[model samples]
Target chain A: MADETTPRLRIAVVGTGLIGGSILLRLHEAGNDVLGWDPQPAARAAAARRRVPFNDRLDVTLKGRDVVFLCGPLRALPESLTEVARLADDGCVITDVGSTKAEIADHAARLGLADRFIPGHPMAGTEKAGLDSAIGSLYDSAPWVLCPSSTDALPGFRLLTRLIIENFGARVVPMEPRAHDAVVALSSHIPHILAGALAGAAAGSAVKQAVLALAAGSFKDGTRVAGTPSSRTADMLISNRAAVVAQLDLVRAVLDGLVASLADADDAELLRRLQVGRGLREELLDRSMLPVTRSFDLARDDQAELDFLRRLGGDGGYVTGQETDATTVTYTALATR
Target chain B: MADETTPRLRIAVVGTGLIGGSILLRLHEAGNDVLGWDPQPAARAAAARRRVPFNDRLDVTLKGRDVVFLCGPLRALPESLTEVARLADDGCVITDVGSTKAEIADHAARLGLADRFIPGHPMAGTEKAGLDSAIGSLYDSAPWVLCPSSTDALPGFRLLTRLIIENFGARVVPMEPRAHDAVVALSSHIPHILAGALAGAAAGSAVKQAVLALAAGSFKDGTRVAGTPSSRTADMLISNRAAVVAQLDLVRAVLDGLVASLADADDAELLRRLQVGRGLREELLDRSMLPVTRSFDLARDDQAELDFLRRLGGDGGYVTGQETDATTVTYTALATR
Candidate 1:
């Protein structure tokens, strides 16, 4: 049984790849005992190099662990989850770093492990893969989403969330599995598709050479994600195929309006559409540059308010905030855990 | 009359804006005497602040000038060209830094100034505009294309090309007027349209707010050029409407193929297309990172070789190269002018 009083927890990291290795490296540094399991010998060797205990045997790795983090690629997650679910000790919480969460949640539910499986995804990645690219701070300042299978999993979800927040310094957001997939589909998955499609379109053109020469900041930025490995991008699209198709449908509808405007030679409508686009982009950039402050009417002595303050303190061991009033508070929404 | 031996040349720049102001600043620093004319008081005042001489009278600025550069917005170019032609001295070797060349070349031909007009475009710009955004090194290492009206104007073409090369440190490329328009439509014009359209499409979507929150590097890069002023982008597309439409058709065709592949649920085909895209992007990035070297076989004692050497020497006042043999020569394609 794990000790309840000590802050340090035992973390079993499955698939010692980029996300997994990063998790091991970070959790270990935070005074947690982390054991890793990867089928690949190279990955295990890499984990060993980082001084993270490695075992090819899933049964041995999950012994007395408080949490099991499945950080394998999209295709490997189901099998990895099945193995972890079968072997992990009772009361051990389960989570993952898969880009898609709906299918993983379904799989865990089918295995009668719904309460233990708190699906997760970190919205941070480079166009790199493998253990060599892993870094402890990969999740730093990035959104780390948690999608618990059911309300009954609240206790386990909170445990995993605290670990991610305190150890990884990641912003933990609670979201539904399907909603998470849909949101990411709109924000990230479709953008990746568009980037690749745009790059692909340029490649297949007769003026391909000239296009390459004239590509500036815009073209380079638009197509930056196209440099991601083909298998990785393909896997992401395939895993979330339904959500991706839905997002593509939305994009197609927008393009249809543009096509009609172009067909009619309606310069005014085209210009209007473009103007709206400029405004939206400006708003996004402005929001990112500007800090957002929120004012809430909360009694300082309230339990909920104190809980919020304690979580912030536990996140980085210390946090400072201003008290606006005896019965109200205003602060920047930092530590959105 | 301008002195042939001296590096200095008497130049007149119309519409003292970003492109024109940058040209004036760089050329003046290279010991050239430059005068400017702009209907906008603010533009002329900005030029004056930069110590670039300006006169409200077109006749005064154009007096005895060897070259007259038209650097106005797309909508203002025709009127600017007419006034420059009506006032500038004969054999002034009139040129422009307009994005589109065919229409301007046609306008100059109609005004009986075709023989002296050599249309040019520097394939470089920032999202920012006006004199404040002007920088002396705006054209450095940029592709400065020149489209002379006729071969009989070779002397004038060479002079303008040499000016762009030595004064601005630009790579001067000679192309036909229509060809320049068509190529730029493929390379720069259409990409700008896509950037704006992509951003516009996102804004028009139901998930606009979500997209704004979730936008990563790819979305931002793809939409960077969309932040450019609507009037400017609209002007560019309208000025080169036919070419822009043609390029749009090409893009639509590619999208059609992709949409069909997606509709069929052809994961393999979709992945194939994405793979091609990834490969193409890799090739582009690889080529950019690698330096290109070209070798030309020529006789060392040839007059053509000697003339090339002289131009290179006069360009920066010094030249160096490796000689292969007494009967053969090798040189870098530095001074294409």
Candidate 2:
């Protein structure tokens, strides 16, 4: 494996699905020499078609690679990493794009690659999945969570983290593996459950036609992730069951409160519950979490920027950057509250 | 009140809020003489500022109007319509923009105004509300549900319906008041509950910061409606309590199944649940329940139109008008799965 002196990193993407393929494509665009491997013949062929430096043999792909990213599904990651450990060169940093981190980290630790394995979860996805949905810029401006098995002081982990943040243009954030799992359970997994349940309820209803007819922007956007491939969604849910269940319990409590308010015709209580949700959303927006960056020089205040700011729908937007004489206005349309 | 011979209809909007103000603005732009009334001094002043022909006195606004629209909250609609009934000129149709229809229809019947009351709910809203959020094109291509107490033969009701469909450009669908309530409970109420609960759960979580940071597009869209003012949402929920509760039960059952699937680590069950939701969403898109009209001539084969049809997200789109060289293509991006 090349040392820090090497200018271009050698990267191996272990699966050419949505997350894996997108990562490879993006890293390749960022000047990394990326090799890809997917067990499925069609998937590998598709990656090859996209000119993703495909290698049929996983062992061959791993050899001499600076880092091997096990970008397989949650259920398959443990075994995939095991194979990576067996085949990959020593001193090479290992990472993953798994949804849940604790189990993956434990598996890496048991395989004697704990310190080298930085469990990463890019907080980015689309309703679509697989190679067909892979885009080179998917991870740009996305939050990439890294839960290092050891400390970030580890050279290999730090180098890999820097590469992801700098090359991929992702905002790298550090957290404990358990904390990552728990937070995503509330933010990602439970929302999927909510969407799936809504779609299921509507699908199962006698008024299915009407429900479909009336489903508007809110319903569609809210339930968009429910359309993700079933296998992938299931893997994430089951692998992260404890956290998701904890979030579900909270969801049920909130729902029960709403139901009680409805039953009692307590408008005030219902209003309070709704207000609490709205206030939380506003707080989320003001916190500047998940911002969409918009940059423009103050000398030429673009009408598009103004319109974007004015029409900034959802929670609202967070406007940052000061007005120096030659000020470049950089704003992120964050948790638009 | 003017008859069919009148060049422009004189319309009185009883509430100068989002729905009412938008309707007034749009109708005024469509050449209707639109007058607005609101008990709130601020709302009245705002409407007047927008040149909404604000009349603080309801009777003054309704004196000679062809139609009186009681555009207020579900809770206030009964009283608003009662006031409209007392003031509106003889033979003038009365309608409402309340989310729930059954209770309002009953109230109208009790007040001896059912024959002239066409209970309506335009299935269009944004998280923003009040006079400030009012826009002229808000109802364009949106579904305007009408639960007419009397049949279409009623002159006043038919005239108002025609004006809404032809002038406001909203798709007018006739439905029974109870049926409308039942359908919307599934389509609108349950989705709001899902959004609010998700936002509330995320907000109440220990990892609110991380949840906000990691929140993606689906989560944002899924929880968008939760940003709506608490009072308004509570009113909608309470007025449609029975239907909302029924829908909530369905939601609970679906959620329980998903929970069980996760607990058992039953990948197949989880996949089936996700697929069911996906399939329902697909069916919704295919049905073209919510549609926007787009037209193009066949003589010029529009690449954009073709791309729109092929790349039509969700369940796909409906294509109409054959290639007779003189034919025009029309499509709607509805129920995007």
Candidate 3:
């Protein structure tokens, strides 16, 4: 899609909610021929009001488009993709902005779109929803996880990664679908779940007012994501049930040890438990040590590049930029502890 | 004391660390005769450098002081109180700024300072320590918990409460020592522990770098307090051991239920748990409902006023201000759910 033959990219975002709207706004601002389509007339009207190119017909939205992004609710993804599969041209590489990736990746595989459809999750969100909530700079410096499993998808994956990096200013981290699900469960889902529980406990207490008043900082932050719409949060959690449940077990184990140390009045044990998370945070935040950057020069169609990309992402490395040749991608990763 | 015989206040802050220095700064800035003392020369020097009156002699600092605040480490508090007890005048009502109150209250009881010593806990802090971190506005709108047990301390307690409200701009909350510890164990200590554990789990992960990079907002806030000096956090948790242990059990139970719901794929139960914390946070944050305000006219020396004050604080009420007559106080409490 980004080849010299087609210098001007043709990009379409299906379902213009916050994520899609953001993508459409970004691609359009970057001077790409971007089109948006949402089955909901209200969403279409809103996008039209924002001066986004919203087409009523799926044929027009997908016609000769180089890339199309599915940003509908998880439940509607398969049908949305089915519609795109019937209408989209062969050159159109499909991608998605979804939280959990394994099931969708499987669905793409069954539909013979796995080679072209890259499951992506952008690490940017707010408590609010809808196209009106979308902003042009939503993905600025945000890590966007892209799972490219099929070797046949190498060329499309490379082009999409380049566009996401260049147009959206998103750092692209490529990993396995299952791995992405597991990592995000710990990083996002479990925290949101804990937030709800913590907030609920405080609200349920007899001293709710005092507790809430005292929660000016830590408590408020700890339970901050509990404010996210419950339905959306529930969807993300339930879909990644295995990974989130496993992470919850880990946190509970840590909490159990601290609780025991407290109950036993063991000062040494308690201090030890509390300090476990400290060193890593300090090291992560220490500015003296800069992240290590490495570059990979890949042949556009090489299957081996997928393995290299997976290893880089699995180890928490992200592609910083596509070099002048576009085949050479720069990867930046935290200095290993 | 606010007595007509010696209306101008004479206050002493007996430790020149952050809390002590902040108190000294506030009182000194309010045009009071505020004296400061600390065994550590560095602290005293810092206070002196800031033009806060730091007398080397404890007796001189305590001389004719109407209120002396013993602001020292939790372990050193008893010794600090003993020295204040030895040097402070009969008119001096002694108080200490400590996190937990049970053990210190017990020591005060045995030292015969219980009647005159009003145990206080100010709900304000920063991760950093030392007088260099002191800010004059630390308690501007913060809650200052006062555990006033004995009837003999009523007159002194009244004076200190009025001074804290009118001069320091703090809302005085009156409660029992045991109750204050219990409430804070839930409000402060438990959240700190959770923050440390959550931050630790992320930092300790195999994907630590990726997780930390993605932790721009919610995770950052959730684990913010885990950055507090390990020693101070440890001391607070250990001292409030029993209550923290109990609260941890409650959190663990909630987490366990959420985990089970996730594992069982119980969407209804998961949604229920997540929404538990949402409603309370929404209600607490909604400004349409103003707090209920009431007036309490106390006969300065009445023993029954202690019970009234206790009820107010236990229900999360705080003294907003002292009326011009000084015998009447304004109590502002959150409207009950």
Candidate 4:
């Protein structure tokens, strides 16, 4: 909600890459006074070229800002927050947009800024990076995860939550720092790592060239996240080491079970596993819970069937005995022979 | 090449789905007199709605047709070809577009139509199917694989090759039937099976709902093919059983090596494997061997760094840094970092 008499809240955004720039752009579009800071000169120039407001001096940028959003590498957040804590107003809200939370929260406590910090991670990103890739609507309808520590500053958390909901049009999902790290480790980090690994393996083989030649839309989409900077991915794994390791263990366990099924040549079990996986994917797609777009093919086919039903009069029903599910849709039309 | 004086060929296309419909549409666009045949009334209606010329009478559709293209289920191809052989002109150029070739080739030989048939497969598909999903440019720049038998229908083969190139703009690749099956088994069938199995496993789990909710773009992309009919997949596996078994053995070996490396915590070997896979993907991507829409996200940071050299007024050069491979990328980035 905007009050004409009250001045707009000023927000400082560090790291003007995709995530940071996107957050800045959204806040700006929402009529908030937003300024950006980035250590990389190229990134800073890119942000400025894109008309994203920025201040070169971090101290000046932090001065009197109602909220400072740390949107950089997970490892960089601790020291950056420490620097801002020393310069920012006592009542200013501090939040982060990193992938992991436990370590950052710990660092906030160590920096004695825990009470003023609200650790938040938006579950949104594109394969591209930098301000050039930023879009104002990037976070719309995405989940903005808020990892609240036991000693978290309630007022800061509330303000950050409101910004996420009202300004970015994102739903606020509160999660424990460790739990959030673990869930993401399973859902995001490990997948990226595995994709990179799979791509690497395929790359090293004699068939590598042909494999790529044959690769269709699926492989490209599957490996999209693997294209991120190795440096950033490195920091992610290192900063969230324990949780990542834990997720890796889970992945290995799953893989091991799969390997066993293959070893036993249990076709029935294999088929069951396949059906279950397809079901899971469909359920998520139907619910719009996943961040990816469901294939238009699926939507079109569903609509086509619905259209067929509508064309048939209310009293006209065709019983073509066919089982329909996410993985398969069969139609057997009854006709007078 | 089109010659204005050349008599127009009468072509019969016996199916109208993603691959078949695409071939028919493209051929029709190239000025061939195309007649479509499908048992399903809805499929026939959809083809007609798309203005794909069709004859409802199968006998009329096949009679006097210069060439007949059987584009339907792998299992249905043999019977359909047999029926076409009985009705079509004695020396009609016949080709069937199915993923697997050896069995169909055998069927043709057994049916005494080997001289009239040129076994072929088009290595391209969209996630969508049906006549409405067809696109004229679907086969552009993709491989159209042909498996020529000893009977050597040279005239038919050449005519078919010219037609595919002229109409679909595909690169005709000639391979032995066995080789064609093997290559696709590794590249297509096995991947679909894996996707289905993975989807099933995840769906069957206690965390099924949550797991699906967090399924990122990768899982969705990786599992897109899982939605195809299980019977279709089973037929593929059975027809190409030997090749699929061989590829699975290779995959299993690789997976085993990875498991051992993980179990031993042999960082060097693990890094080596990771490098191999990454290099495979990058090399494929860089060469444009894959039919992927070029996205900046897939570009390696190293490539970005190389591109950045243009700003320094130096000739752009590839970096031969100490860690050029995927293993180095993974270990240095994920584990050791």
Candidate 5:
């Protein structure tokens, strides 16, 4: 029986980069004894410098740890998990922070670690990765989805979830692994892929620099995820091939609908589509729940000056009299709708 | 032959909407004799109450004005320009702030008023529209693209350009009407359409309210253009159908290439694409010359944070230090190289 207050559980964190290192940091911050291991020498060095307890040997890192978190690219997770299951102490719990969990979970089960492995994805990250990127508060207020297989060890699963919520201050949501993968493919993966593609096409041209010069906030925001390392991105696409492809198909269908509307000269339909899009975009803005990091400010104090111009044009427009201060301008409704 | 020091010329602006109202306010602020004309009874009343010279009849407003600026949706521009061209004195110069130039210019030329009409598009606007949305410095330092036919009256074109620069503090760049249409299609029209389409697809099935809640800065910027009126967007797309279609095709080709890369599972190629995108996005942020408006602060600050996060996760590990009162973050060169 695990003691609630004096829990003597050991944890192993593999591939100690941004996500892994962050897990380790947060775990340590919570007073947990953790062992860190990575195949890359730099990563191992990084863990040591950051005072993350490091073992160069994976087997040594997993020898006594009660739980092992596989925090690597989606493609790398399966092999790493397999290695841990083969060499680690019997009954050690394993989980992952990979974006796509369905395939990883399936691979873990195939590698005979299903009963001990729980597929979990922390829905938080910066475009940046690596050991130095790790922070104690990375998972604070973020959603961490736990996808458990039917045959998974119950006590181990519950313990992992409890640790995530209590230690990391994260909200744990349970869902089917495949469903988690699909949702992320639509919300996160596809958008990143598209942004990268758009940027790549623009950059490969003769006027590449000029094209970038003309880019605005929209392009920057839409393509922010494209700045992530290619290896990580590639691993995501390859591992989550089925889900990403499905999302792309949906995107293509939507594009075709738009093309049809344009081709049919259906302005009303096109306008409707635009209106729906605008409404949806506005809704998204209001929620602030998604992982998007930007915000839109619509109010400008100088708006009255514009209204005053319209009035001067003899259109019988009224300017709002709310000038709070020099740097701040506010316009009230001239005539109520 | 126009004298530089001639007392501010009388200008009549029709529409009293965002563009027209702004121009009128700017002209009046510059000490020009400006009058606004709008058919909407409420609009005319509002303008009159604001002490602006308001006239409901276009003919009365156009009678003595030395210039008439058509500022409205594209659908309204051709008729407004035609009306002014028919009524205004032969010497009166006419211009517009419409998005498409070729169609408007062609209509003017066919109407035998090409010399009097200098098609212009001021590359400045907010997501908001209508007279209430107008602001004094709307066109300040913004690019005003001028499309003047070769055989058109040169003096009239020059006069229009001068007025744009002097009255609104905008810089005018002259180009052919077709070229202007094409460029705007790539820069403005295509972006708007893509934004609308993406928002439409992403808004799928998620509760309208929930979707809005989760939206962050990127979604807002990406969908900023979608907030524009459906009629205006429809007109823009329909009026510049050929060019827009071409741009859409280009965008599709880019997407196709990305899909192919993903299918091939080429990690190297994928990384190259992402790096290229990152470089382009960064360059664009640095090179953008547009005025800082409402969206500027939010985007700039968010971008700075993202950059900070990226450097922390970069190949060159982070070096955290204190700089005076601020916590400074720096990246050191990778040990591998």
Candidate 6:
């Protein structure tokens, strides 16, 4: 998958879970020098059995790498990134695949690795878990989020984004760390709360048997994440409190609006509220409506370029491709509001 | 709207459809002086051949009846009841075989027929339909639900319950009209509300394109029921207003609790709440978890029996069997607190 523009990237992927293993496999298949690591020997052995390029010593595996992806668990990422920053060459572009970004961005800043440490969250997963489910195409067409702290980190961001666009088939989205959290709070965290609440509310009803019989596909889908171990879901929800809480207030408003409409016997208002969501949902699901792409040359004023990237992310756009020299970046998106 | 007639009853069945024809056939066989009317000659002629007493004029058919069964389609029930109330004598016990109770109950109240009009739903059907399928044994052992509006309607409700229990071979369960609506609201209306809201929230997120790609099973499933036509969903929710509003309040509280826990960094409380819902959902899903049931006597205290009947329907319980004399009602239910 490596085109003529791609350099032979020396990449190390820490943590051989789905994201790490997939990143390792994809880079290795792209004719790169790639190595994988896992804190657990059993996990490393499992990947090794798959004929993956795996090493037992994480520090040695991370050494001399041009690109190091810290794909460890959220709790382990900060320490692991510190280790990767310490071992890998000063030229190494470090990134990660964690759901949230702000806390880690703060840690990277305090460690003075802003230029080398590019925070990322590649939006990819499968129902299956662990290394066996890892595939080379995991990041294909997926949105890989990047939170660039300042103008100094532009080169590292460009290097990793270009490599991904060229070989891994990822769509790069450069967003503010907080914005990423807000978006996920609406999309992921709120749904979990709604799911548990719905299940809980129904369970307490006098007509629970009726609810059980009637709650079919919708109830199941809504509550699917509540099935995740409670402590894990709580950790994820609590980890990004500000975004999750702000978005939850918005949700409470939406619900309160519905309740008021019902209380007033306002069928017209009820229909209006219900229709707003329906229209938006239809837009989200509308595959036929191909989004337009806009591009800006990085050679322009640096502030202008950064502003464009931020606007692109704000517009729900992602960088799809770029000039080999990294002068211009083109992204697919709706027009900025 | 009507006074009580003596024990011996004059019964009439309107619409001559599957349910109407069956009621006519069964009541005529039990020697209740029954009459059947169908606006369509073909349907009535067909029922006539099946030995169902037919009257060409609906006014004459309904003139002297002590009980009238408005077994028309949902869309036609309101108009049919209006016509029946116009022609029937004041003492007539007006009832109907309709699925959802709230809308028609509201209409009956508007028509000042709340005392006479008791909404009913019989959980019995076959692959076969129409007058030809009208067997005297059709309602045998079937659960017939009666939504009693008030104690003024209790006499009418009692008369109909006795008739259905004796001649129709039915088991009677009395529930308040709004309570029945609430029961169904928790089961059906609330799911639709949740689905639409979840979809709407995601579509409005700032990084919605990322959300579109990343909000997987939970997002899709949560909004799955929202695919139902908007006007249709709105109408269903609005019709069952009180119950849905109350239940949605409970849902909002649950969501608020999760938000507070996340805000306070109270992982333990968050886990406790989430685990409660998870346990409830699993219990709902567990086929092996047979719930305990307890029944009370209907003859012991008539006043208490009314309250118990309300509780039974509220508890998602149903009348399964009864003493043929209607002295003791046997219901399937979870133990009441």
Residues A226-279 of candidate 6 have per-residue lDDT tens digits of 777686677778778888888877667777777788889888988888887787
Candidate 2 local lDDT, A16-115, one digit each (tens):
8889989888877766788888898888768767776788888888889888878867788898888888888887888888888999888888887877
List, residue by residue over B1-337, the lDDT tens digit for candidate 2. Answer: 2334455677888887888889888877777788888888898768767776787787788998878888877777787777778878877888889888899888878887777888888878776678878999887777677665543313444466567766667755556678778878877887887788888877787667667877866667778888877777787788888988877888899989988888777778888998998887776556633455666664554544444432332122222211212365444344333
Which residue ranges in model 3 land beyond 4 Å of their true spot?
A1-5, A287-303, A323-337, B1-6, B287-303, B324-337
Model 1: pairs clashing at backbone N, Cα or C within 3 Å: A222-B222
After best superposition, candidate 1 residue A296: deviation in angstroms?
16
TM-score of candidate 6 to 2 decimals: 0.71
**lDDT value, residue B75 of candidate 4:** 76
The most accurate candidate by lDDT is: 3
lDDT of 6 by residue, B112-197 (tens): 99888999876555535578777778777655779887756766776777678767766565677766666657655787788777
- Displacement of residue B53 (Cα, Å) in model 1 is 4.2
TM-score quality measure for candidate 2: 0.81
Give DockQ: model 5: 0.16
Give the RMSD in angstroms, all C-alphas superposed, for model 2.
11.7
Report lDDT per candidate. 0.70, 0.73, 0.78, 0.64, 0.65, 0.74
Ranking by TM-score: 3, 1, 2, 4, 5, 6
Which candidate, 2 or 5, has the higher DockQ? Answer: 2
Task: Give the per-residue lDDT of model 1 (tens digit) for A1-337.
Answer: 1234345678898887788888877877777888888888787667667777788787999989889989888998998888888888988899999988899999999998888888888777766666777898998866677776655665576567667767777766556677667667766777677677667777877656555655656567767788888778778878887887877776656655655665577889878877876897897686432233445555333444334433332221112223344455544444421
Clashes of each: 1, 7, 2, 17, 27, 0
**lDDT for each residue of candidate 4 in A1-337, tens digit (9 for 90 to 100):** 2433335778899788889999888877777788888888787678767877888888888899888888876767888888888899998888898888898888888877777888887877887878889999987766666655643354455456556767777655555577667656655666556555445545444454444545555456545555665556556655666766655555555555544554466656655555555565666566532121122133345554433322221111222223334543343322111
Which 10 successive residues of model 5 chain B have the least lDDT summed? B316-325
Worst 10 residues of 1 chain A by lDDT: A313-322
- For residue B49, model 6's alpha carbon misses the true position, in angstroms, by 30
Quote each prediction's TM-score: 0.82, 0.81, 0.92, 0.76, 0.71, 0.71
